[model samples]
Target chain A: MNLRILIDRFACRFSAFLSVCCVALLALIAVGLIYKSWPILLEHSLSELLFSTIWSPMKGKFGFLSFIISTFQITIFSLLIAFPICLLSATYLVELAPRSILKIVLPLIDILAGVPSVIYGIWGVLMIVPCIRDHIAPFFGYTTSGYCILTGSLVLAIMVVPVMMHLLIQVLQAVPHELRDSTLSLGATHWQMIKLVVWRKCLPGIMATTILGISKAIGETIAVLMVVGNVVQIPKNLFESGYPLPALIANNYGEMLSIPQYDAALMFAALILLAVILFFNMASAYILKRVTKSIT
Target chain B: MMKHKYFKKLEEQFFFGLMQLATVTILFGLLFILFTILWKGIPNLSWEMISQKPQGGFYMGGGGGILNAICGSLLLGLGSTILGLLLSIPIVIWLNIYAGQYSRNAVMVRTALDMLWGIPSIVFGAFGFIIMLALGIKASLLAGIVTLTLLILPIMVRGMDEVIKTIPKELHESTLSLGATRWEMATRVILRKALPGIVTATLLGFGRAIGDAAAVMFTAGFTDNIPQKLTDPVASLPLSIFFQLGSPFEIVRGRAYAAALVLTIIILVISFLSRLITAKYQKHSR
Candidate 1:
C-alpha cells in the first residue's frame, strides 16, 4: 500500500511538472522570437518599422506599413462578409431547422472546417481567382489578374464560415427554452423574440466569435498568400494586389537570409503577428468568461 | 394597428427567407468546391500515381507518381500525432485530476494553450527554424515533426480536456472509494472511460499535422525520395501540391488537383471515423 501511494505521489509531481512546461512553452516562444528579432529592432525605431513602406531588403530598408494595412484590410473585409452569414445560419439552425436538418448540417460544417487550408488555396487559385477576374471584376468595371485582396477576402470568408457558424449555433442553442417561450407568450412573433431576447443574450458571444475569427484570419498564410498576389503595396481597392505579414515571412524567409538583417526583419514580422494574435485571443477569452459567469 | 402588425409580419418573413438563402448559399459553395476537385482530379488520379515515386523531370510533365510525398506525409503525421498525444495526455490528466478543474493553475494553462492555438502555423514554422539555427540542425523529418507537434499540441489538449470534463463526477468518486490510487484511477478508470475521446483527439491532430504546409515548409526540406532516417529531408502532399500547382505546365497542375483529392479524402475519412467512434463509445459512458 505504501509503495502504491509513493508511486501515486511521483506520478502527480511528474504530471504537474509537465503542465508547467506547457505554460512555459508559450513564454519561451515569445522570448525566442524577441531575441532573434533584436538586431532589426535595434537598427530601426518601432514607429518607422511599422509606418515606412520602402521594403528593399538588399539595400537594408524594411518598412512594414503596406503589409500591416493589407493584413487589416483582408481580415476585416473577410470578417464583414462572414459574420452576417454565420449569424443568420446559426439562427436558422437553432430556431427554425428541424432535427433531421440539424443532424446533416452539423456534420457538414465539421467536415468543411476540417478541410485543409492548402486545399482551400488550390480551390481559390482555380475557381475564385478566375471567377473574379472573368466575371466579378469585369462587372465592376475593372480587370485584375485574378489574384488580389478581394480574392483573398472571398476565399477566407468561405474558409472561416464553418467554424464561426458552428460556434454561433452553440451560443444560440444555449439560450434557455423558458426565455424563448416567455417572449412568445407575450405575443411577439418568432423573429421578434429572436431579435429582442436571443440576439441580445448572445451579443457577447458573437463579439467573442468575431474576435476569434479575426485572429484566425490574420494568421492564415498559405491560402491568403496563394491568392493575395504578394505585391508590396497598400491596396487602394479590393481589386489591387497587396502583401500581408504572414505571406511576407512565408514567401521570403529561407531564400533571402544571406542579406544582412533579413532574418531579423522576418523574425520581427513573426513577433508582430504573434503579439496581435495573442491580444485578440485574450480579449475573446475575457468576453467568454463574462458570458459564462452571467449565464450561471 | 392592423397595418403595423402586417408590416411586422412581413419583416419577419423577409428576414427568415434571407436566413434560409444564406444557409443554402454556404452549402452550395462547399459542394461546388468538392465538385470542381473531383471533375478535374479523377481522370488523372491513376493507380500508378499512388504507388510510384516521382521520376526525372516530373515537374516538367514527366512520368511517375507522388508515392514519396504520400509516404512521407503519413510518416510525419503519425510521428507528430504520437508525440503530441504523449505530451497532451499528461497535461490534461494533471488539469482534470491533480489540479482541481477550476484551479488557478488549470485556468492559466488553458489560457496559455489558447494563446498558443491562435498563433499561426507559419509562426510556429518560423520559431522552429529559429530553434534549429540555434542548435545547428538542418531541415529534416525530425525538425518537421517537432514543429508540427507544437502546432497541434493545443488542439489535442483542448479536445481531450473537453471530453474528460464530461465524465461524471460520481465516476471519479467511485474509483477513489474502491481504494484505487490517483495514478491507478487515472490510468485504469478515467483513461478507459475517455479512450474513444482520446482517439478522436489523436486523429484530429494527425489530420492537422498532415494537411499543414506552412508549419513544415522551412522545417521539412522537400525531397524526391522518402527519408530513410529522421535527419533526412522529407516531402509532403500539401507542399507537393503547392509546388505542382505553381508549375506552368498543365499536366503538373492536374496532378496538384489529384494530390488534393487524396488529401481531402484522408480528412473526410478521419472525420467519419471519429463520428463512428464517438457513437460507439458513448453507450459505454454515463
Candidate 2:
C-alpha cells in the first residue's frame, strides 16, 4: 500500500514534467536553429545574404532574394485566387445554403481538407502542370517547361481553398442568428444584409482566416516544389520558373554536406521560413482570441 | 426605387451564382483529382507493387514494388502515434485534471500548441536535423520518429485537450467526492470519458504523420529496404512519391502515381473510420 502511494506521487509529478518538457521543446527548436545557422550568419554580411539575388552556393554565394521574392509572389497569387472564391463559398454556405445541401457540401470540404499534400503534389504534376504548360502558358507567350509560379499558385490555391472556406464559414456562422434576423427585418436585401452586417462584423475573423491561408501557402513544400520549376532566379513574370525558400532547402539540403557553408545557408533559410510562419500564426491567434472574446 | 430594387436583386443573384460556382469548383476539383489519380494509377498497381521490395534500378522502371515504402510509412506512423499519445495524454490530463481550465499555465500551453500547430513540416525537418547533429544521431528511423513526434505533438494535444475539456466538471467533482485520488480520477474517470476522443486524436496525428513528406524527408533518409534497426534509414510513401516522380522514366512516374493512390486510400480510410468512430461513440458521451 505504501509503494502504491509512492507510485501515485511519482505519476503525478511525471505527468507535469511531460507538459513542461513540451514547452521547453519549442524553445529548444528556436535556439537550435539559430545556433546551427550562426556560422553562416557570422561569415556572411546579413544585407548581402538577404538582399542580393545571386544564390550559387556552389561558389559560396548565398543570397536568398530570389527565393524570398518567389515565395511572396506565389503566396500572394494563391491568396488572390483563394480569397474571393473562399469568401463566396463560405458566405453561401453560411447564409444561403439549405441544410440538405450543407450536409453534402460540408463533408466534401472536410474530405478535401484531409487529402494529403503529397497526393496534391502528384495531382498537380499530372493535371495542373500539363494544363498550364499547354493551355495557359501559351496565352502568356511564355515558352518553357510547365513548371512555373502560376502552376504552383493554382495548385496551392486549390489546396488552401477548403481550409480558408472552413474558417470563413465558421466565422460567418458565428455571427449570431439574431444579428441576421435583425438585419433582415431592417428591410435590407439578403445580399445587403450579409454585406453590411455579416461581412462587416466578421472582418477581423476574415483577416485571421486570410493570414492562416497565407501561412499555409507560404509553408507548403511538396506540392509547390513539384510544380514550381524551382529555377534559382527571381521570376520576371508569373509564367517564369522561380524558386521559393522551402523548395530551395528541400532540393539542396541533401547535397549540403559536400558544399561549404551550404548547410548553414539552408538553416538560415529554414529560420526565415519559421519566423514568417510563426509571425503569421501569432497574429492570427491574437485576432482569433480577440474575435472570440468579443463574441463571448 | 424600382430601378434600385431591380439592381439589388440582380447583384444578389449574380454573387450567389458565383458562390455556387465556387462551391462546384471545389467539389469538382476534388472529384477530378481523385478520379485522375485512380484512373492513371490503378492500371500500374499490381500485387507485386504492393508486396515486393524495389529491385535495382526501380526508379528507372526496373522490377520491384513499393513494399519498403509502405512498411516504412506504417512503422513511422505507428511509432509516432504511440509516442505522440504517450506525450499528449499526460499533457491533456495535466491541463484538465491538474491545472484546471482557467489556469494561466493552461492558457500558455494552449497558445504554445497553437503556435506549434501552425508551423510547417519543413521547419520541423530542419529543427530535427539540427537536434540530430547536436546529438550525433544519423538520419535514421529514430531521427524520423523523433521529428514526427514533435510534428504531431501539438495536433494530438490540442485535439485531445478540446475533447477532455468537454467532459463536465461535475463528473470531476463527483469522482473526487468519492474519495478517489487525482490519479485515480484521471485514469478511471477522465480517461474513460475521453477515450474515444483520445483515439480520434491518435488517428488524426497518425494520418498527419503518415502523409507528411517534408518533416520526414531529411530525417528519415530514403532507402529501398525497410530498416532492421532504429538507426537504419527508412523510406516513406511521401518521399517515395517525391523521388519516383522526380525520376525521368515514364514507368517510374506511373509507379509514383500508384504509390500516391495507395497513400491516398490509406488516409481516406483513416479519416472515414475516425469519423465513424466519433459519430458512434460521441452519441453515448452526450
Candidate 3:
C-alpha cells in the first residue's frame, strides 16, 4: 500500500510539472508579441498606438484600427461564403453519403488540405482575377481590376472549406447514432430527422467549429496578401483592393526603418488578433467538450 | 410486399445518387484547382529553368537557379523543427507524467499556444522582423530559423501533448510498478510508446514551416543562391513565388505558376508521407 501510494504520488507530481512546461506555450506567444512589438511600444506611447489613424510607414505614422476593419470585413465575408457549402457537404458526407463514395471523398478533401496557400494565390491571381474582370466586373461596372475585398473573401472561403469540413464532420459524426436512430425509427423522414434531432444535438459543436474556422480565416496572411492587392484604403466596393493588419505588416515590415513604434503598432495588431482568436478557440473547445460529454 | 420493396429500392437509389454527386462536386473542385497549375505550368518546366533565377526574358534566361531557394527552405524548416522539438519535448513529458489530473491549471498555457498557432503567419513575419532587427541577425538564415522555431513550437508541443495524454494511465502505473524511476518510465516506456505520434506531429509542423512564406519573408530576406554559411541571406519557394507573382513582367508571372506547381507537389508528397507514417504506425502498433 505504501509503495502504491508513492507511485500514485509520483505520477501526480510528474503530470503537474509536465503541464506547467507545456503551458509555457502561452509565454512564447507573449514573447513573440513583445519581441516583435516592443520597439513599436517604446517609440510610441500606448494611447497613440491604440487611437491614432495615420499609417505612413515611411514618415513614421502607424494606425492599427483601420486594418482591424479590413480584417473583420474580409473574414466575415469569407465565412459567409464557406460556411453553408461546407456544412452541406459535411452534412451529406456524415449523415447521407454511402461508404464507398465517402472513402474516396474524404481523401480528396485531405488532398485539398495539403495544397499550399501560395498555390491558392496563384489560382486567385491568374484565374479568379480574370474571371472577375471579364464576368463579375461588367455586371458591377468595374472592369480589368480584380483585386478587392470580394476576391480575398472568395479565395479565403475556398481555402477554409477543408478545415471547417474536417471539424464539422468530426462533430456531426459524433452525434449519437441513437438520436437519429430513434427519430428515424419513428418513421420520420431522413431530412426531418436530421433537421429536428441530429442538428439540434449537434448545434453547439457546429457553432464552436464554425467560430474556430472563422478565426483561422481571419488570421490568414500569405494567400490573402498575395491576391488581395494590398491597396491601402477603406474599400468602397468589394472589388477595390485594401489592406488588413496582416497584409499591412507583410507589405511594410521589412521596409520600415527606425520606426520602433510602427513595429509596436504591429504588435498591437498581433495582440488584438491573438486575444480574439484565443477567446474563440477557448469558447469553441469548451462548447465542443460540453456537447460531446453531455450526450455521452 | 413485392411492390413496397420496389419503392424502397427506388428511394435508396435516389439518396445514394445525390450523395455521390455531392461527393463528386467537392472532389473534382479540389482536383481541378490542383491540376490547373500543373497543366498550365508543366510545359514551361525544365532543367535550365531550375538552374537560373527567374528574370525578365523567356523561361530559359537570366537571374539564377532555384538551387538556393530549395536549399534555404529545407534548412530553415528542418533547423526550426528540430530546435522547437528539443525545446518542447521535456514539457510534453512533464505534462504527461507529472501534471497528475489538475491539467486545468495549464489551461492558460494551452490557450496561449493556440493563440500563437492562430496568429497569422504575417503577424509572425512582422514580429520576426522586429527580433531580427533587435538582435542584428539582418535577414540571415539564422534569424529565419529562430523565428520559425517560435511559430512552430506551440503546434509541436500541443500535438505531442495530446498524443502523450492519450497514453492510458495504466501504462504509467505498470511501468512504475516495475521499480523504474519516474525518469526511467518517461525515457524508456511512455516516450517509446508515443514516439510515432510525436514523429507525426513533428512532420506536420515541419511541413507547415516549409510551406510558410509570409513568416520568413522579412526575417530570411531574399537570396537566390544556397547559403554556404548560416549567417547568409536566403530565399524560399513561397517568397520566391510571392516576389515573382508581384513582379511587373508577365513571363515572371508564368514562371511563378511553374514554381507554385513545384512547391504544391512537394507539399502534397510531404503530406501523403505524413499520413502514411501516422496511419501505418497506428495500424501496426495497435
Candidate 4:
C-alpha cells in the first residue's frame, strides 16, 4: 500500500511538472524572439521601424509600415467578406435548417476546415487569380497580374469561413432553447426570436469568434504569400499588389544571412506577428470566459 | 397597420432568402474547389509520379517522381505526431486529473494552450529556427519534426482535453472508491475510456503536421533526396506542390495538382476515419 501511494504521488508530481513546462513554453518563445531581435531594436528607433515606408535593405533602412498596412488590409477585408456569410449560414444551421441539411452541412464544414492551406493557395492560383486578372479586373477597368490584395482576400475569406462558421454555430447552439422557445411563445416570429433573443445572447460569443478568426487570418503565411503579389508597396487599391509581414519573413529569412541586421529585422517581424496574435487570442479568451461564466 | 405588417413580412422573407443564398454560395464554393482539383489533378496523377524519385531538373519539366517528398513527409508526420502525443498526453492528463478542472493552474495552462494554438505555424517555424541556431543545429528532419511538434502540441492537447473533460465526475469517484490511486485511475479508467478520442486527436495532429508547409519550410530545408538520418535535409509534398506550381513548365504544374490531390485525399480520409471512430466508440462510452 505504501509503495503504491508513493508511486501515485510521484506520477502526479511528474505530470504537474510537465504541465508547467507547457505553460512556460509560450513565455520562452516570446522571450527568445525578443532576444533574437535585440540587435535590430538597438540599431533603429521603434517608431521608425514600424511607421517608416522606406525599405532599402542595403542602406540599412527597414520600414515595416507597408507590410503592416497590407496585413491589416487583407485580414480586415477577408473578415468583412467572411463574417456575414458565416453569420447567416450559422443562424440558418442553428435556428432553421432541417436535420437532413444539418447532417450534410456539418460534415462539409469539417472537411473544409481540414483541407490544407496550401491546397487553398493552389486553388487560388489556378482559379481566383486568373478570374481576377481576366474577368473581375477587366470588368472594373483595371489591369493586374492576377496576384493582388483582392485575390489574397478572396482565398483567405474562403479559408476562414468554415472556421468562423463552425464557431458561430456552436455559439448559437449554446443559446438556451428555453429562452428561444419563450420568445416565440410570446407571439414573436421565428426571425424576431432569433434576431432579438438568440443573437442578443450570442453577441459576446460571436464577437469572440470573429476576433479569433482575425487572429487566424493575421498569422496565415504560405497561402497568402503564394496568392498576394509580394510587391513592397502599400496597395492603393484592391487591384494593386501588396506585401504582408508573414510573407516578408518567409520570403527573406533564408537569404537574410548575407545582409547585416536582416535576420534580426525578420525576427522583429515575427515578434510583432506573435504579439498581435497573442493579444487577439487573450482578448477572445477573456470574452469567452465571461460568456461561459454567465451561462453557468 | 396592415401595410406595416406586410412590410415586416417582406423583410423577414428577404432575409431568409439571403440566408439561403449565403449557404448555397458557401457550399458551391467548396464544391468548386474540389471539382477544380479533381478536374485538373486526375489526368496529371500518374503511377510514375507516385512510385519513383525525381529525376535531374524535375522542376524544369524533368521526368521523375516525387517519391522522395512522399517518404520525407510521411517520416516527418509520423515523427512529429508521435512526439506531440507523448508530450500532450501528460499535460492533458495533468489538466484533467491532477490539476482539477476549475483550478487556477489548469485554467492558466488551458489559456496558454489556446494562445499557442492561435499562433501561426510560420511563427512557430521562425521560433524553431532561432532555437536551432542557439543549439548549433542545422535545418534537417530533426529540426522540422521539433518545429512541427510545437505547431501541433496545442492541437493534440486541446483535442484530448475536450474528450477527457466529458468523462463524468461519477466515474472518477467510483474509480477512487474502488481504491485505485489517481495515477492508476488515470491510466486504467480514464485512458481506456478516452482511447477512441485519443486516437482521433492523434490523427488530427498527424493530418495537420503532414499538410503544413510554412512551419517546415525553413526547418526542413528542401532537398530532392530522401533523408536517411535525422540530421539530413528532407522534402515535403506541400513544398513540392509549391515549387512545382511555380515552375514555368506546364508539365510540372500538372504534377502540382497531382500532389495537391494526394494531400487533399489524405486529409479527407483522416477526417472520415475519425468520424467513424467517434461514432463507433460513442456507443460504448455512454
Candidate 5:
C-alpha cells in the first residue's frame, strides 16, 4: 500500500513538471518570433517599410503601402460581397431548413472548410479566371485582359463564406427558441421577427463573424496569389494588378538572393501581417466579449 | 383588426421570400465552388499520374511520381503527430493535476498556449528557419518535423486535456485506494477512460499536419526529386501543386491537379474515419 501510494505521489509531481515545460516552450516561441523579426525592421527602418510609395525589390526599393492598400481593397471588396450572403445562409440553416436537409448541408459546409487552399488556387487559375475574362468581363465593358481585385475578391468571398458561416451558424443556432416563440406570439410575422428579434439579438455575433471573416480573407496567400495579377505597382480600379502582403511574401521570399535586406523585407512584410491579424483578432474578440456580456 | 392582419400576412410572405432566396444563394455558392474544384480536378486524374515522379520537361511524361511526397507527407504527419503527443501528454497531465500550486502564473501558462494558435504560420516558419539554421540542419525534413510538432502541439494538448479532465474523480480515487501506483492508475484507469479522446485529438492533429502547406513549405523547402537522406530537401504535394499550377506547361499543371485530387480524396477518407470514431464514442456514452 505504501509503495503504491508513493508511486502515485511521484506521478502527480511528474505531470505538474511537464505542463510547465510545455507552457514555457510556447512562451519561448512567441518571444523568439517577435525578437528575430526585429532584424527586418532594423535594416529597412519602419518608415521605409511602411510609408514609401514603391516596393520593387530588384531596384532595392521596399515600400509596402501599396500592398497594404491592395490587401484592404481586396478584403473590403470581399466582405461587401460575401457577408450578406453568409448571413442569409446562416439564417436559412438555423431558421428555415428542415431537419432532413440540415443534416446533409452542415457537413458539406464543414468539408469545404477543410479543403486545401491550393485546390482553390488551381481552380481559380484554370477555370474561374478564364471564364470570368471570356464570359463575365465583356458584359461589364471589361476586356479579355481583366482579372483583378474584383475576380480575386469574388473567390475570396467564396472562401470566406465557409468561415463566416461556421461562426454565424453556431451562434444563431444557440439563440433561444423562446425568443422566436415570443416574437411570433406578439403578432410579428416570421420575416419581421427575424429582422427585428432574431437579428437584433444576433447583431453582435454577425458583426463578430464579419470581423473574423475579414481576418481569414486578409491572411490568405495561395488563392489570392493565383488570381491577384500580382504586379508590384498600386492597383487602380478593380481591373489593375496589385499584391497583398501575404502574396508579396510568398512570391518574393524564395527568389530574393544576394540581398539579405530583401529577405528581411519579407520578414518585415510578415510582421505587418502579424500586426494586421492581431488587430483583427482583437476586434473579433472585443465584439465577442461585448456580445456575450450584453446578450444575457 | 382582421383587415390589418391580412395585410400583415402579405408583408410577411414578401420578406420571407427574399430571406429564403438569400439563404439559398450562399448555400448554392458553396456547392458551385465544390463542383468547380471537383470538375477541374477529376477529369485530369489517373492512377499512373499519382504514382509517378517528375522527370522530363512538362510533357515527356515523368521523372518523379508523387510517391516521395506521399511518403514524406505520411512520415511527416505521423512523425510530428507522435512527437507532439509524446511531448504534450506529459504537460497536459501535469497541468490539470498539479498547476494549481503555481496559481499566479497559471494564467500566464494558459495565455501562452492560447497565443500559440494566434501567431501566424509565417512567424512559425521564420522561427523554425532560425532554429534549423542554428542547428546546422538548415531546411531539412527534421526542421519540418520539429516546426510542425510545435505548430500542432497546442491543439493536441487542449484536445487531450479536455478529454482527460472529464474522467470521473471517483475512478482515480478508487484505483489509488486499491494501492495502484500512479503510473498504473494513469495507465489503467485515467488513460483507459481518455483513450478515445486522445485518439480523436491525434487524428485531428494528423489532419492539420497533412493539409498544412505554408509553414511546412518554408521549413521543408521544395524539391522535385525525392530525398535520399534526412538532411536532403523534399517536396510536399501542396508545394508541388503550388509550383506546377502557375507553370506555362499544361502537362505539369495537369499532373498537379491529379496530385491534388488524390490528396483531397485521402483527406476526405481520413477525416471521415476520424469523425466516425469520435461520433461512435459519443453515441456509446449517451
Candidate 6:
C-alpha cells in the first residue's frame, strides 16, 4: 500500500511537469521562428520585403507582394464559393432535417472532414484540375495550361466546405429555441422565423466562421501546391497561374540552404503565414466573445 | 390574400430546395471522391505491393512496392500519437481536474490552444525545420515525430478536455470527500470515466499525424528504405502519394490513387470506430 501511494505521488509530479511543457512549447516555437527570421529582417526594409513584388531569391531580392496577394486572392475567392453553400446546408441541418436524417448526414460530414489533405490534392490533380484545364479554362479563353488561380480556389472551396459547414451548424444549434418559437408564434412562417430570428441572432458567429474558414484556406499547403501552377507572380486574372504563401514555402524550403539568406527568407515567409493565421484566429475569438455577450 | 399565400409558399419552397441542393452536393462530392479513389486504387493494390520495399526505378513502371512508406508512416504516426498523448493527457487533466472549471487560467489556456489549433501545418513544419537546424539534426524520423507531436498536441488536448468537461462536478467532489488525493481521484475516477474519449482523442491525433504531409514533408526526409533508427530519414504514405502522383508515368499515377485509397479507408475506419467508442461511453456516463 505504501509503495502504491509513493508511485501515485511520483505520477502527480510527472504529470505536472508534462503539463508545463505543453505551455512552454508554444513560446519556444514563437521564439525560434523570430530568431531564425531576424537575419532577413535585418538585411531588408519591411516595405522592401513585403511589397517589392520581385522575389528573385537568387539575386537576394525578396519581396512577398505577389505571394501575399495570391494567398488573399485564393482565400477570398474560395470563401466566396463556399459561403452560401455552407450557410444553407448548416441551416438545413439545424432547421429542416429531421433527427433521423441528421444522424446519418452528420456522420458523413464528419467522415469527410477527416479525409487527409493529400487525398484532396490527389483528387484535385486527377479530377478537378483536368476539368478546369479542358473544359472551364477553355471557356474563359485561358490559352496556357489549366493550373491557375481559379483551379486552386475551386479546390480549396471544396475542402473548406466541410469545416465551415460544421462550424456554422454549431453556431446555429446554439441559438435559443425560444427565439424561433416566439418568432413563429407571431404569424411568421418557418423560413421567415429562421431568417429574421436565428440568422440575426447568430450573425457574429457566422462572421467568425468566415474568418476561421479563411484561416484554414490560407494554411492549406499540399492541395494548393499541387494545382496552383506555382509561378512567382501576381496573377493578372483568375485564369492565370500564381503562387500562394504556403505553397512557396513548401516548394522551395528544401533548396533554401543552397542560396544566400534564402533559408532566412523562407522562415520570414513562414512567420508571415503564422502571423496571418494568428490574426484571423484572434479576430474570430473576439467576435465569438461578442456573440455570446449579445446572446445573453 | 390568396396571391400573398401563393408567394409565401413559393419563397419557402425555393429556399428549402436550395438547402437540400447544398446538402446533396456535399454528399455527392464525398461519394464521388471515394468512388474515384477506390476505382483507381484497388486494381494496383496487391500483397506484393504492400509487403515489399521499392526496388530501383520504382517511379518508372517500377518493380517494387511501397512497404517502406507504409512502415515509416506507422512508425511516425504511432510515435507522435504516443508522445502527444503524454503531453495532452496531463494538460487536459490540469485544465479539468487541477484548475477549477471557470478559472481564468483555464480559459486562457483553452484560448491559446484554440489559436494553436488554427495555425497551419506548414508553419509547424517550418518551425520544426528551424529547430532541426538549431540542434544540428537532419531531416529524420525523430524530427518528424517531434514536429508531429506538436502538430497534434493541441487537437488531443482539446478533444480530451471536452470529454473531461462532460463529467459532472459532483463526481469530483464525491471522490475528494472520500479522502482521496486529487491525483488518485483523477486516475481512479475521471480517467476511467473518460477512457473512451481518451482513446478517441489518441486515435484522432493518430489520424491527423498519419495524414499530414506538410508537417512531415521537410522534417521527415523521404527514403526508399524503412528506417532502422530514430535518426534515419523516412517516407510517409502521404508523401508517397504525393511523389507518385507527380510522376510522369500513368502506372505510377495509379499507385498514387492506391495509396490515397488506403489512407482514406484508414481514416474513415478511425472516424467510425471513434464514434462507436464515444457512443459506448456516453451510455455509461448517462
TM-score of chain A of each: 0.98, 0.96, 0.87, 0.97, 0.89, 0.94
Worst 10 residues of 4 chain A by lDDT: A187-196
TM-score, predicted candidate 6 vs. hidden true structure:
0.97
Candidate 1 lDDT, B1-286, residue by residue in tens: 9999999999999999999998998899888888888887899899988899999999899998999999999989999999998899889999999998889999999889989989999999999999999998999999999999999999999999999999899999999999999889889999888999999999989999999999999899899998999999999999998889889999999899999999999989999999899888877654
Taking the tens digit of each residue's C-alpha lDDT, what string does model 3 give over A1-296? 57755865665565556546545545555677866667777777777765666777767777665677788889999999888777767888888767776677777677677577888888888778788878997887875478878889988988888888888888888877778878988987786676678778779988998988888897888888877777766677788887877777677665456564665666677777777777787787788778767867
TM-score for chain B of each model, two decimals = 0.98, 0.98, 0.86, 0.98, 0.87, 0.98
**Candidate 6: lDDT over CA atoms?**
0.88
Q: DockQ of each candidate's interface versus the true one?
A: 0.85, 0.75, 0.37, 0.82, 0.50, 0.68
lDDT of 1 by residue, A10-88 (tens): 9899989988987898999999999999999999999999999999999989999999999999999999999998899
lDDT of 2 by residue, A182-259 (tens): 889989999999888899999999999999999999999999999999898889988899899999889887788898
The residue-by-residue lDDT of candidate 6 on B154-225, one tens digit each, is 999999998889888999999999988787888889998889989999999999999999999989999999
Between candidates 2 and 3, name the one with more favorable DockQ.
2
* Candidate 1 Cα deviation (angstroms), residue B162: 0.6
Per-residue alpha-carbon lDDT of model 4 for A25-74, expressed as tens digits? 99999999999999999999999999999998888999999999999999
Which regions of candidate 5 deviate over 4 angstroms?
Answer: A1-30, A37-40, A144-146, A290-296, B1-11, B58-64, B100-111, B161-187
Clash number by candidate, in order? 0, 0, 23, 0, 11, 0
Q: Score each candidate by Cα lDDT.
A: 0.92, 0.89, 0.76, 0.92, 0.75, 0.88
How high a TM-score does candidate 2 get?
A: 0.98
Model 1 CAPRI quality: high
lDDT of 3 by residue, B65-159 (tens): 56566778889989999988887776676655654433765555666666666666766776677667667777888889988887888889888
Estimate TM-scores for all models.
0.99, 0.98, 0.87, 0.99, 0.89, 0.97
